[model samples]
Target chain A: MFPTPIQKRPVAAQALYQGLLPIALIMWLLPLIAVALFSIRPFSDFGAGNYWGWPSSFEMFHNYGQVFFNSDMPRYLWNSVLITVPTVVGAVALSCMTGFALGIYRFRGNLLIFFMFIAGNFVPFQILMVPVRDFTVSAGLYDTKLGLVLFHIAFQTGFCTLFMRNFIRALPYELIEAARVEGVSEWRIFWYVVLPLMRPATAALSVLIFTFIWNDYFWALVLTQGPNAQPVTAGITSFNSQFVAQYHLMSAGSIVAAIPPVAMFFLMQRHFIAGLTLGAVK
Target chain B: MSVTAPAVPHAPSERGWFQRNRMTLTPLLFLLPGVLFFAVYVVIPIFQSFQISLYEWDGLGEATYIGLGNYQELMTDRAFEVSIWNNVKWLVLYLLAIPAGLFIALFLNQTVVGIRLYKSLFFFPFVLSQVVVGLVFSWFYLPREGILNGVLAFFGLEPVNVLGDPTLATYGIIAAGLWPQTAYCMILYLTGLNAVDPEQIEAGRLDGAKGIRMLWYVVLPQLKPATFIAFVVTIIGALRSFDLISIMTNGGPFGSTRVLSFYMFEKALSEYGFRMGYGAAIAVVLFLIMLIFIGYFLWQMWQDEKEARR
Candidate 1:
């Protein structure tokens, strides 16, 4: 509106604006588009120097089939799901209680605790790397999916608590007061009153957390090893090494690794954006 | 009604201490699990890392008290200096995303046909993992078969190897990082723009402000929240740049692209020898730098909280 809507512009300017949109989008996504194009091409195309030309043969299924059936990609994908789902559930469940407490109750150390979560959420991962790995190793949870899941749930709680607490704060407080006056116990009040109202926040946090855990490379590298427990982000490197210089296959593999989160974003675009843009408007 | 009335009188007399004090107990009970987890994995480790940085250890043996020996060594390490300089560069240049995002947001702000689909498509890059972005850009910068070179050839200019050259490699990776970061900022601005007051825009028009003038004086002041968030995220993202450097260059072409995060990992974990003490020391430096921003952010939030309380 600030630029003056195109509807109010001259016909020539409107036409030009319409034409420019597609060009800008294409240019913006060109790098990703290149990878998509590369993924579907036959392996021979790279050898024949047909990189920019139309693919000599479409091997979309074959290349993707190799990733799914022939390699350890499926194993890695499964590891990612196994790791991500638990982390999402654990982080969300933990944050909901924390959010409820901080939002609903007046207590000593409330803001102090809240600020601790926020500050912890922003600290560099490096600072925690050595000690966390040390703790994990000592606990005999090293190189295990459970190890990754636990750490993720713990670390993600910081961000999730910040998000959930803020959201819960904005809820109507009278509902809880009414529930309390009805002689409902505190736990029941949370379960029956506050929990139901937090659905949108829960959905938003779940999708965001799912995508985050799935795309996590640093933790996966630190806590896990080999195809047995490594998530797809870390596993993609090994997948590439196994097929070094096979650009088509490597491209396909990386695409496959990227798809779960991409699909999650698309399906939950409303919630995802709602979660991400929570602070942008206000 | 009679049964409920009879039960009400008995309830308070039969109530235990837990029921009598549920108000105070409830929040603490609910807070226990999350607090425990956060303290163990996040809070305690921060202190532990500080402790580890002072001791010389190989991560497998007894650590000796060195008392800033690693920091002293860092003063003379060339790679550490390069990494610090690269970090400074990243912090400065990465801020370009904010303005670039605003530009894109303005360009796409209009309600043209199929605009919903266009907005999402424009935001596609941010959703992809940084590993994939790094891989995509690495190939895009390939000296021989890259589309960038192909474009240059089309324009009859010489093709340059972007990531292969030390001088350009860091910039190349930063550009790749910018692709997703810009998308993130654009989405934030788009959302912010949606909530802008129309009355103000119309008032600006009546006052002879148009285009850039309207944007600078009228629109931007309203977009402060979005800008603050953008600045916070961009600064944090710049400092936390590890995955791209790892995936694209691996601190490559003679370690030209290493930032503190990557260098810390290399020192602590990589095959370059597990100097856990040195790595922790590097992390401590990065942590101290981040603390400055963290302190400022918390102070701002504290002020906001006070205002809300008032």
Candidate 2:
């Protein structure tokens, strides 16, 4: 509105604006388009030095089939599901309680504890790297999905708590007060009143956390070494190293690795944006 | 609407003794699992990491307290120096995303057809995993056949080796990083722009404020929250830039692109050697750098909390 919408501008300028939009988008997505194009091509295309040229034949099914059928991609995908689902559930469940407590209560050390969670959320994952891995190893959870799930759940609780607290704070105080005045127990008030109202925030958080844990590579690399426990994010990179010169195959795997989060974003676009743009609007 | 008693000490239950102290205990009960998990994994580890930095250990044996030896070595370690410098460069250059994102947001803020799809497509990079991003860019920077080089060749120019040269490799990876970061910042700004006050903008317009002057005197001030969040995320992104470097260069061409996080991993976990103490020391430095920002973030939040209370 501030810039003056192009429709109000001269006819020529409006036409020019419309013309430039698609071109800009295409140029912006060139790398991705190239990857998609490459994903469908045969490895022979790479060998023939026809990298920029049209593929002689499209092998989309064969290439993608091999990625699924021949590789540990399925197991890695399974590991991602195994790790991410529990993390989303754990982080969301924990944050709901913490968020309810922090948002509703004004006791001493409340802000301090909230700030602790906020601070920990912002801290680099490196600080926890050596000790967490060592801790995981000592606990005999090393190279296991449970180790990754526990670590992610804890780390993600920081962000999710921040989100859930702000959301819970925004809810109507009277409803909660009404429940309390009815002589309902505190836990019951939270259970029946607050939890039912928090469905939207919980949904938003679960989708966001699911994407985060699914795309997490650094922790996957640190905790898990092999296909047995490694998620697709790390496994894709290792797959890159393992299958050198198989750019076609690697591109297929890249697309496969990217699917879940992409689907999550597309499916939960509004909630995803809501979670991310938490502080930007107000 | 506090669970705490407002006027009288209202006792709900007489059957269970827990009702007598429910006010003090209820919140704690709710906070227990989250607090316990966060304490063990995130909070206590800070102190443990600091302690680990003082000891010499390869993680399998006894950790002898060498007391600042790793930090001492860091002072002279050239890779450490390069990593720190590159991190500084990453921090500085990454700030470009703020202005770049604002520019894009301003361009696309208009009511256009398919604008939603356009915004989504522009934001597509952010949704992809960094590993995929790294792979895409590595291929994009391919010397002969990559699209960037292909474009250069089409223009009758020699293809530049982007990721191969040690000096340019860090910058190359940073460029790849910017593609998604700029998109992220743009989304933040677009959201901010949506909430801007039309009355204030009209007032500025009536005063003959236009273009850069209008943006500077009016819009930019209104955009402080978005800018603050953008700064926080970009700084953290720059520091946490391990995936790109690892995927693209792997600190290659004589180890030119090692940020502290990636360097910490190389020291502690890589086949290079398991210098856990040295890694912890590096992590401590990174942590300290982050503490400065974290302190400021907390201070800002604290001020807001005070304002809310008031």
Write candidate 1's Cα lDDT for A1-282 as tens digits. Answer: 666888999999999999999999888988778888998999899999988789999999999999999999999999999999999999999999999999999999999999999999999999999999999999999999999999999999999999999999899989988987898889999999999999999999999999889989999999999899999999999999999989899999999999999999889999999998888987
**Decoy 1 TM-score against native:** 0.97
For model 2 chain B, give the 10-residue run with minimal summed lDDT: B5-14
Query: On a 0 to 100 scale, what is the lDDT of residue B222 in model 2?
Result: 89
- Model 2 is docked with a DockQ of 0.80
TM-score winner: 1
- Each model's TM-score? 0.97, 0.97
CA deviation > 4 Å runs, candidate 2:
B1-15
Tens-digit lDDT track of model 2 for A1-282: 567778889999999999999998888889888888889998888888899789999999998998999888998999999999999999999999999999998789888889889999999888999899999999999999999999999999999899999899989999988988898999998999999999999989988899889988899999999999999999887777667778888888899999999999988999888888888976
For residue A81, give model 1's deviation from the true position in Å.
0.4
User: Model 2, B62-164: lDDT tens per residue?
Assistant: 9999999999999999999999999999999999999999988888888988999999888868988888899999988989658898888889998899999
> Looking at candidate 2, what is the lDDT of residue B83?
91
Write out the backbone clash pairs for model 2: none
TM-score of chain A of each: 0.98, 0.97
Off by over 4 Å in 1: B1-14
